[model samples]
Target: MESFNAGDVAEKIMAAIQKEYKELKTLNVMVLGKTGVGKSTLINNMFSEKLADTGIGKPVTDKIRKIEKPDFPLAIYDTPGLELGGQNVVNALLADVTEEIKKGISSGDIGKMIHCIWYCISTPSHRFEQTEVDFLKAFLNQTSLINVPVIVVLTQSYSKADARSLTAEIEKENLPIVKVVPVLAEDYEIDEEYVAKAFGLDTLSEIINNVIPEAVKKTFIAVQCANLEIKKRRAQAIVATAAITAAATGAIPIPFSDAALLVPEQITMIGSITAVFGIRLEKGTIYAILSATIGTAGTTILGRTVVSNLLKLIPVAGSVAGGIISGATAAALTAALGEAYITILARVVKGEMNVKDISTAKGKKEIARIFKDLLKIKRDNNGTAIESEIETSADNTNSFEIND
Candidate 1:
């Protein structure tokens, strides 16, 4: 009989993670701005990996460089400070940028294409200079044919009044840009008396999500760290789909010995969630989660191990048949597992927990507690079809909160 030992299950999940990640289409973005506009800070805070500081930046052209991390599915075409000393220099920079976009278009690969552009201005400047306006006019006219979306990012906007003033100024120009967004990418200390908290990057992230092609969104969500709600919505959708599939797989009662039947769906769900959160996971971490949540810390199979352990840890589940489990039972169990894992990953994303702790004794205990707790809430009785868990209803909001 086919069975998934904990080691085998862990290997399967890791393989699935690799497969899903590699399958993601690379997302390409172009950022243009003068120096001191806080572009690096904005980039680092908005994405999962610090693509600005940590990525390998090599000159794609004398004026533009491509920043990329190894095996990461994102390419940021970055420009050096745009002093805009002369019309000729601005024209040269525009030429280099457009040529690069043209190359991506010629390749006929969407991954090679430039999906979006950001033109950042320091809000403290308080005025959108005429030189910058002329450059934007020419740049907009040049890229109009290619249909690239450009967003004017007002960076270092610690003062709401200053940000709003600059925003109105830019809006008056009415270049065909996407929108004018003001962002305080990181907290700023004005003095002993005042500090400005980071804001508006989530709005920027959501705006980008709305504009980018559907093909690149999977990679976008996986790599973006600014918006937890985006990641949660995607993870919850994965859980709902996996739950429905698990229900179908167990529609007919299966003996406990055959519980391995539901293992594949659950493994895929776990892999996809990891990809979405874009968290680094070592094999031991995955093994720890499996051991703590599914069974005791030794050789384990999804079938008998889950039912027997839940019976031990949860008294309300006492009524389930010892030898066999129903479809409703399978769906609830799978949904609980998916939701539990989502909560763990969300905590890691928010810095409330660390991935390194997953292998620790305390971490393992907390994980088990979350899994059992979810199982208690997600228990289904009527074998009803599972719907998406992302409804605005308040009930779900409390259940998935990242605990301290």
Candidate 2:
């Protein structure tokens, strides 16, 4: 049988990942509030990108501005802060926003349309004026007709009591909003002695996640930085899919020379997992990490030698037996690689490890140690001594290879 070409498998996996990444539609959010309500700060803190810095608000109309980063997957529509005194000014602003929404809907792409609206109110203001209330009610009524979810954000909240009071007052009016969320967005300095700590970011992120459509949830998860659990869950799903792919590839019963085919799947799995952590690594970096942890060249030789020896011991020349051994080995190895990378990334995300250290000799040694331990455990649990022995041989060799 022809040896599996690991390079071709790796290319296919990378191409799939890139295609999926590109296909995810951008998440467009409409942020409505008067100026200085922390809209820019909230967006910058909640997402991986510092959108506020790059977000140059282009006027969609006289009052509505669209803030977009070039080639980014998230866009924000910022409306002028409602002025209390002029009824005509408020009406024109509202009309302009409505017209923009209509245009998005007419485009026939829900992804191009505003996914949700965040109506922000500053908590320090203590209470909403009647005009603010009236404007919000009118805006909500207009948006509701098109099924866009509007969430009320109480920004710059200092205390729980203030947040509760504001929420109660809004609820008393019973405006048509998806929910009322109190968020601090960022830490604030009250004086030389006191500071208002940030809070409610996670709750606000969860509400947004729940309100957005399932089709765009992955995009949201990729961009949002407030919720780590959501990222972890998504990463786990990617790892599971990779494990399945590795198992399928192994079922071909190719010879030891072809064992390299499994490397690409594991590498792709690592790349996907890294993305969930919001880290962008170069292709060279990814391959280097894999080589340091898994002994790229040694793993194939070891896996093949071990599997071939096991078949000899069984006195079985059948391909089914060979397929079973290879499939189990691939699944076990891929799972181990994925789980190890996940653990390392979780630590990096949690500030337990320095991301720069990943390229260091000491860091690579630690990763190799964790990967070997996990691989051994997986093989032991699955009753695959041959697989475990292969991992042991790879570990002993400690030979890193860069395939051309």
Give TM-scores for every candidate, taking all chains together and pairing residue i with residue i.
0.89, 0.80
**Could you tell me how far off, in angstroms, the CA of residue 295 lies in candidate 1 after the best superposition?**
1.6
lDDT of 2 at 114: 88
Candidate 2 per-residue C-alpha lDDT over 204-232 given as tens digits, one digit per residue, 9 for 90 to 100 = 88899999988788788878888888888
TM-score, prediction 2: 0.80
User: Which pairs clash inside model 1?
Assistant: none
Location of the lowest summed lDDT over 10 successive residues in candidate 1: 395-404
Candidate 2 local lDDT, residue 174? 80
The lowest-lDDT stretch of 10 consecutive residues in candidate 2 is: 310-319
lDDT of each: 0.80, 0.70
Write down the lDDT that model 2 would get.
0.70
Please, what are the lDDT tens digits per residue for candidate 1 over residues 30-118?
Answer: 99999778888888988878989989999988889899999899999889757788888988998999999899989999999999899
Error of 1 at 312 (Å): 8.9
